[model samples]
Structure formats: C-alpha cells, structure tokens
Target: MTTLVTDTGHPVITAWSAVSPYGIGRDAYAAGLRERRGTVTGLGPEHGTTPDGVGCVVPGFGVREVLGKKGTRSMDRVTGLAVTAVGALLDDAERNRAVGTGEGAAFTLGTTTGSAQSMMDFTRDSLTGEQPFFVDPARFPNTVMNCAAGQSAIWYQLKGPNATIAGGRAAGLHALNYARRLLGSGRARTVLCGAAEEFSPARAWLEHRCLDGTDSADSAEGAVPPLGEGCAMLLVEPRAPEDAGQPVLAEILAVELGVVLDGADPRPALVTCLRSALHRAGATPADVAAVARSGAPGRAGGAETEAVHEVLGTAGPADLTPAPLIGDTGAAAAAFQAAALLAFAADRPQQAAGRIGVITSVDRTGSVGCALLRLR
Candidate 1:
C-alpha cells in the first residue's frame, strides 16, 4: 500500500464526537469497543410492537447538560441527538473560527426520515383533528427529512452549503460522498459529515417487520435483534502538507459505491466495490489490517461475508462487528463503524496506527459502499 502522508488530496478526519449508547463523547464509545461490550438494552412489547428485542439506548441523557433550557423545549429525539453530537464535535474540533460564523463551514447528514416520530405524530394530529387548521404549525418543520441538518446549521451558524441525504445504512458514506465533492470543487474549506438515528416506536416496529420479511434462509432464524439510536459526526478537513504535524485521526483515501439490482446477487457488486476502493487507495486486501463492518442477517449478511472472504482471504480476527455490540443503528451504522476503526487506531495506536482500514456496508435496499481510511 502507498504510505506517504502528504501531497495528496485525501480528506482527513480532524475531529469527531458522538452521543451514543456509550455516552456523550467518543471516549465512552471507544471504551465500549475496547471492552468488547455493547450498550444495548432489552425492549419488550411494552416498549414497542416487538414481542422481545433490544436497543442501544442512551439512558437518562439530560439535554440541559449539553444544550441550555432554550434548546430543549422544542426538540424531538432525532433533532436532540443530532444537535448534541454536532455541539460536541465543534467543541472537540475547536473550529469556532471557521464554522461558528458560517465562514467556510459545510454540513451534510444522512437520515431515513427526518424523524419517524415527528412525521407520524404530525400526520396523525392532522387527520385526527377537527380540521387541518388545528395542526400545530410549530411542529411542521420537524417532519422535513432535512430537519437535523438544517437545525445543526442554524444552531452553529454554518452558512456554507448544508445538505441531507435519504441514504439508509449507506447514509454515512453518502454524506462523505457529498462532502468530498463539495470540498474537491473548493466549495467549502471543511465539512462536518455524519448520520443520525433516534430510537422510536415507529422505527422499532418497522425494523421488526423488515427483519421478519427477510426470507433468505441464511438468517439466524427469525430472531431479529434490536435497533440502536444516536448520532455520529466527523470533522472532515482537507489534508495539507503543513498540517501533517497535527494529530491526524484518519485519512480517507476513497469513498466507493455499488448497487445490486433487485432479484440479483449482491456478492458481485460488493466484491467490485471493495476491489475498486482498495485499488484507488493503492492497496490490496492484504493491506487492510482490519475491516470494521457488519451487514444485515439473511442474504445481504451472507453476501457481505462471502464477498469479504472471497476478496480478503479470511474473515478472521481482522473482521470486527460493532452491530452485535451496538445493535442495528440503521442510518447511523456506517458512521459508527468508521468511528470504531478510528477508535481502535487511537486507543491502541501501537497495534492499529499506520495500518489501513475499511468500513464496508450493505443496506437492505441494495445500496453498498465502503470508505477506505488510514490512521496516522
């Protein structure tokens, strides 16, 4: 693999933070990964439609602790999670000068829906009300799919380009793809890219049904686990020769995408995507020290595993699954997997730094992609 650090256009993750099941910052999440412990909690029928399930939930998170009273009054869980994660990321990156006044800051996020709860509630209120006039105008904005990204921009005064993607499990990389294009064209100096998902009854029920519908005999019976919630944000900045001395978290070599048409095999698409990503990074499967990734259980899951093994030799210890530990994070899955790789490199530098890593994902809707990254 090519090992030079400077004179390349690769974007490096300068700073990152999260409000995950582990806690309010990346430290807690890192600790959880190191201990091989997942922070998911059991959710019985009382919590949602599932007879039995689990979820990676943040227990007793006080909003006032992160955002003042003014910020908590009119927020939904998705917005709260996004705002909280962005606040921590800005604080950690100390990008106030560049991002605070809407100077050169760009923001992008991924989400399935703005907030399932917000949309369902708003729609229900409209239909159940005596008339359309009875709907709450104040709550209308929360139903927009771009609410989180727009809210984050407004909260931080980021005036640069702000966008949101409707990517499912591929959301994180979708944001990365957009950020790369924006930055590559000199549209922005830096971009905060990530994805968020909030656990809700509507989301939980939908996921249960989706898992139940997966008829690919490869699944572990009908025992669909649980879902996870939270946001993962990364401060992606352009790499420069002079900034090489700074502590570089990870340099993104490339972001690759693939699609498997309906009623077709996904293994071919996945293999082609992985091969292209490695080739672009001037590396091969052997150069990838570890793969921080996971996939859906049935056919998608089986395809992902077979592709990795067929291309990378073996699925051995080098393969890591953050899902079993964190449950299924849906839109936030890719971001968390990327974070897991960075966390391993940071917390165990001696073993992980200077090594190439990749985060591969295969969403339910035939969307598949991987981000090639190297920790400095």
Candidate 2:
C-alpha cells in the first residue's frame, strides 16, 4: 500500500472555505492575515436580546441570502453556516467545472453540536404544550450528528460516499482524513470536505461546567480561548493539477490520529501524534514553517499544546487560537485553522520555502490529531 502522502492519487484542495466573522470572507480573511488584524469581538445573546458581552460574532452574509428562504428555515444557525460555506465552495468549483453533474463528488462534514439549539427550542416548546412547536419533519434529518454532511451533499447535488465524524475539536481534521481516504481509494472523483459548529447555550453551559471558572473569561476580548462561531468547506479532488480556477491552497502532506486515555497526560500523546504526522509526510520539525493549533485556551488544552511545541522546538510562529479573531468554532476550529494556513501561505514571505504548515487539534475526550500541509 502506498503511503498516504506518496499515493500520487493524493487529493488536492481546490475551491475551499468562506468564513463568516464580523462580515469576513476570503478577502477579509486574507487581509486579516496580511495586516495581522484581530477581529475578535464580544457576543451578545443568541437571539440578540442580551447586551453584547464577549465572543466572536460572525458578520456579513446571512444564511437566507445564500441558502434561500426554504433552505435557511430547515437548518439551525450553525448548520446554516455550514451550508453557506459549502455553497461557496461548490460555487467556485462549478465555475471551473471541477464539479459537475455526475462528477462523483462526496461530502464529509464535522460538527459537535448538530442542531442542539433546535432540539433545545423544541424541548422548551413541548414542555409548555405549545402545539409541539410546529417542528418540520423534513428538518428532522438535520438533527443528527451527520446532518451537516448529508445536507451539504443534498444541497450541492453530490453523489458519492459521504460520512461525518465527531471527535469533538479534532472532528474537522478527522473529516479531512476521511476525504483523503475516499479520494486515494478511488472511491470518488471529487470530495467536498468541511466542518461546522454552532454556538448554543447548552454547549456553552456544558463547556463552562467542564472548564475551571478561573480560566474561563468572556470571549469578546483577547481571552485565550473564546467561544467562536462559523463553518468552512474545502473541495478535494484526486488530481494534483486540475483546471480549477481557484488557486491551489496547499497539498495535504499527511494526517494522523492519536487517542489518549481520559486522565493521561496529553503531552506525550500529542508529541507522538505530531511526530507521526511529520514522519509520514517525510518532514522534520525544522521542515515545518508554522503550527496552526486549536488554541482553545483551556488550561489543559493550552498547556498540552505548549508542551508539543516545546517538544518540536518550534518556539513561536504558531497560530494559536485564531479565536482572537474567529473565536473557537468547535469542530470547525481546525478546518478554520486549515483555511488560515492556506491564506497564510498565499501571502507569506518566501522565507517559508520548504516549510510545511502543521494543523493540530485535541478534543475533550483526550484524542489528538495532526495534519501536515505543505505549501506548494
């Protein structure tokens, strides 16, 4: 069997990603990277009733405008974001003919809270016996963990093997790995790979309950790990050089997953994961130019990432917590980081030549995943 990196059949990232943060897009994201602009802002209540306190709020591009009225109503805000991002990806691909009818395209969506807000809302309405809240049965399909991927495929009219993986924060990278496998195995011609996470009171409550109150701070300011919202999509194809109009972002050098026990020190596991990813990519620590990390700002998560950096001797070029601008986007965090890496490579100095970009993530379950993206 050929190594994941050397398969030559390796999938290339073509048209990918439209991030929504304070009205940001590829251009704004690129500008932010070029100018080092930090867009992290405070978040108000989910319904916009509460005063703005703290957190990264997505600006620009409402879901209805992209997905249309019917599509928007069928999805929660998080899924709506995912659909919009994927829509952007497909639109780019369609313009270049990289995607077409019967092109055998697939989708892999990663997410943590799949319609949790919808469920919560439905539950509240049912508790009050308010006519069962008039939930559309058609939307029931989107209530599950894999709903994002399924909806993406339906929305884009892609027909191929599709799956969804939820490894918490690592879910996004895991989805990339899955897409790579499908392309490498000749299972599909093109794959739309992406991840999405929607912020919900239930999720925030749970995270707060899990985190040490001391480290927990409002998300608006430059707090280490602020809650974030958004979705990102990447179009992956088996061909290395296709006629796709969008610029080739980066080549997927290698991806690996490592699981640590519930109470074990994550440092060792993370180190092992990073080392394996680099080895598989035939790269060394020195070969990496930057590290795009989860940077959740959780005490353990932050400490564990720092320990990994110390092991690799990669001191500070790391893009820890893009949340200072994008906030923590749950499963989309890593994918967003991946998008950031693409943006970074698109404009960074050539001094980064021969240097690969590494994306790493750790979930609450103690699973760590790392992907090595080589700038081509």
Best by TM-score: 1
How many residue pairs clash per model? 0, 10
lDDT (Cα, tens digit) per residue for candidate 2, span 82-126: 767776665554543446324567788887757676667666655
Off by over 4 Å in 1: 1-8, 43-53, 62-66, 93-101, 213-223, 315-317
lDDT of 1 at 195: 95
- Any runs in candidate 2 off by more than 4 Å, and if so which? 1-7, 22-24, 44-52, 93-97, 130-139, 213-224, 241-247, 316-321
Cα lDDT tens digits, model 1, 143-227, are 9999888888889888778999978888999998888887777777778899999888888777756664563353462234467
